[model samples]
Target: MSRRGYARADRPGRPATASAGSAPNTVYPARRSARACEGAAVGADIVIIGAGFAGAATAFHLARLGRTDVLIIEREASAGVHSSGRNAAIIREHADDAAEQALLHAGANVLRRGELAAFDRRGLFIVGPGQDEAARYCPRASGRGTWHPDDGTIDVSGLLGRYLEGQRVLYGVTVLDWTHGAHGLTVRTTEGDVDCRLLVNAAGPWAGEVGKLPLTPYNRHLMVSTPMPWVDGRWPVIWDGYRHFYFRPESGGLLFSCCDETPGRPGVYEEDPKILDTLQQRIETLQPALGAIAIRTTWVGQRTFAPDRRFVIGFDPRDERVFHVAGLGGHGVTASYAIGLRAAEIITGKLDGRDDPFGAGRLF
Candidate 1:
């Protein structure tokens, strides 16, 4: 549950603070292992290894901190192909820890500041006899078992777009290998090679495979109904405390989740027909209108977690030049801003005294 240095928000040619590695701004004069160096050094001062929320957030913060010559790379053709893109898009500004509360609201603040706030302050409800644990989220309960007025929905895509517009990104770039050199690393990729002073492993589920971290992939499903004309699409999202089912309104219909989190590998996965059957069997009592409505479609996404269900952000124990920001089980979208800034701060050697609750040092 430790979060710390993920990127050294330093700009190109700036004296790097990395100890285990050096920032050799000079071009790689050495011959390429396969092809010759085309013209300019095909590398950046800092290379972000993933294009998901973590990568995008770090890129945005790094740019905000005035870092140029930085590159954000993604294996997918577009951003948010994994956890971020597939999130429920809820801005849950409810947590017990004061710092966590700040981080949660900061994410919502970024959305609102960027004009991407189409929120439902009516409240995020904790259904089915909410537990005492729910009391923290539902501070101002009107009548429900539990309700969080501060918890609202966000335009995740819009927020991401706002940050992505100013950064240099390369999509469809598959990172193949990393061979440590004199003072940095030569990253082998499907497209070509990139020599950089620093490398960030924000590769999400692939973090374990890429950076020697242990992460377990959990599969979750979401189903959308055709349309429930009678039901209000504006109603706040409902989450069952124990049943582990959740639903929110979207596009004239409701999106439902079995609250299913199954262990699996990263790839396209089929819908669990049993989850659909469960919804069909329980809809009568859950919501007659939603039950009456036919399910339009279903899909699956993977959420990754470490042994502890918290984020892993910081430098590699042995290699200071290499950093990681993965194992963000389900908090990727909710705490993207805070996590991103902290990671960038640590990497750039400007931590500004933030506590390291989710720091990777705890594991290393």
Candidate 2:
């Protein structure tokens, strides 16, 4: 991995040395052992760790379900500081496995239309000069796959903001450790401590380490090119079915991504030249007309997946008080709201469908 100057930090492997409060690095006083568990009976009702898309969406739905006393703790300075903000070329795919297809369907129902004013309906066109290998998202039809007008993009940060409405998020707070017992859950963070009735693990790539789930992190990189005045924002997202390379309009510029998933631990990822080279090769080979576009920026983020690559969304098999909403992989942005809704169902004991698909019990 080559070093580069870019940010968007999400995964939680870095040590928590900062302080609490509005000021950066302002550490709040740690609670005494007796005071830690002393709070509004059973702490904050709910304490969600990790304020990325998964956590934010869950918190949003939880609020919608009338459980607004949730406390979302984030290690980064703000929400979506990592994977949530880093991923731009997001789309919903109905053509996938049963679980993913279900998630896509549910997610579309929640985010595709209606009140999500931030929804961008540019559509997704999966082109093919080669094989439609990404057919799981869009199976081929005739010589090429048709445009998925139903697929769309969301301002991840903005979505996080919407989900965060009426919710309490403690920014710059890192949960150093937690205790889940019959009484309740007490989370000790770098900033301070909080007790909660239920603990939701939406920690993205760090869920396995933070909540004891068997999840693994894979690093992915995305590039944004210098503005191309001739590029049309009306142009739907174009993706090379075989190359795993996709690009979409970004403020008169373009956001590009390659299928570069390198297995790594949770931590800051140094820029990789090989992935950039892959992006370069993609442009030269397929969209030759956009050859003049130069990459202006790049950054890396992680996508955690379960052993089966499906999202883990139910209460921990070992403990009913612990719930999971992680292991989204690349389907996160597209299916986030749906996962959140599902997580809400699990938390509130109102699940309409079977939760076995993404249940943490599957890990064992």
Candidate 3:
């Protein structure tokens, strides 16, 4: 519904053990002044940077908890303009580790149970051409409890639209700087400044540049096709284990992804033309029937990853008032709710180091 506020009685607990006397690692020189804008001066209990799934979910969880003084700052003209909107939108119960698996399962349940909203479950299929790749996707498939020959796809656009409807989002506003002090955090944005006691850095790909955080970037790509009903809309979300290619149904057409990982600088990145050839070859090997499908349009997006691929959630190591909720890579859509709840719990002191494996200490 609306943006969430902070709890009156239950403020954030004592700063975590690791946050004491720590300072953020500065990278570049800070801008000298704030930007001019028009708006009533607003203050929030929590200020989240980024309007992607991670930030939106955090705002939703906070509202559900009856904490309403939350504001989300997004750089784009609308929400989900980047990775959140660019993804294949497949919800999977599979994870690489116990902690992540739990979050994945929990998020999948939220989608299936209609907690986020009514979502169509076409089911996810991890097609493996050989034994090694099968072994890799098997645990995740087994954990999901459903495996089918057809490709599974989720309605990502529908889910995001539903979740964000009627919510107060400051679109086209970019957070330029933030300072955490004894009083709380003061963030400067492209529009104006927001003063809040708690801050969540749910800024997906640009998380590393958002207020001096320790986040790494990874490269990924996705492509869309012309409307083709012949390609079974019910095709299970296909992952060519051998070629690292994946595809899912979007609207009536098919959306394919080349699971390409490359070294690069972080920011909104465009796709390389060579990736199209790579995707075509992979699709030919994995699903021969769809090889003939024409590629109507294509684009690329960065999938930011942490050092361990597990999410980095919890208070900032250097600043207790600043929180980190990022590094979802391709799992942001699947793990959004769980991660948001966990971040809110940490912010409100409902959860501590003992409750989450994604604590900031992991980065140490």
Give the winner by lDDT.
2
Ranking under lDDT, best-scoring first?
A: 2, 1, 3
Number of the top candidate by TM-score? 2
Judged by TM-score relative to the true structure, which candidate is superior, 1 or 2?
A: 2
Q: Compared with the true structure, what per-residue lDDT tens digits does model 2 show for residues 288-340? A: 65666677777787888898888899888787778888898888878888889
Per-residue error (Å), model 1, residue 6: 23
- Where model 2 places Cα greater than 4 Å from the true spot, the runs are 1-42, 128-143, 352-355
Ranking by TM-score: 2, 1, 3
- Local accuracy by lDDT, each model: 0.67, 0.69, 0.65
- Score candidate 1 by lDDT: 0.67
Question: Per-residue lDDT tens digits of candidate 3, residues 221-340?
Answer: 767777875655655565553457767666477777778887557664655769878877876655555647777666666678887888988887777788888888878888888888
Deviation (Å) of 54 in candidate 1: 0.7
Q: What are the candidates' C-alpha RMSDs? A: 10.9, 8.7, 10.8
TM-scores for every predicted model: 0.80, 0.81, 0.79
Alpha carbon deviation, residue 39, candidate 1 (Å): 9.0
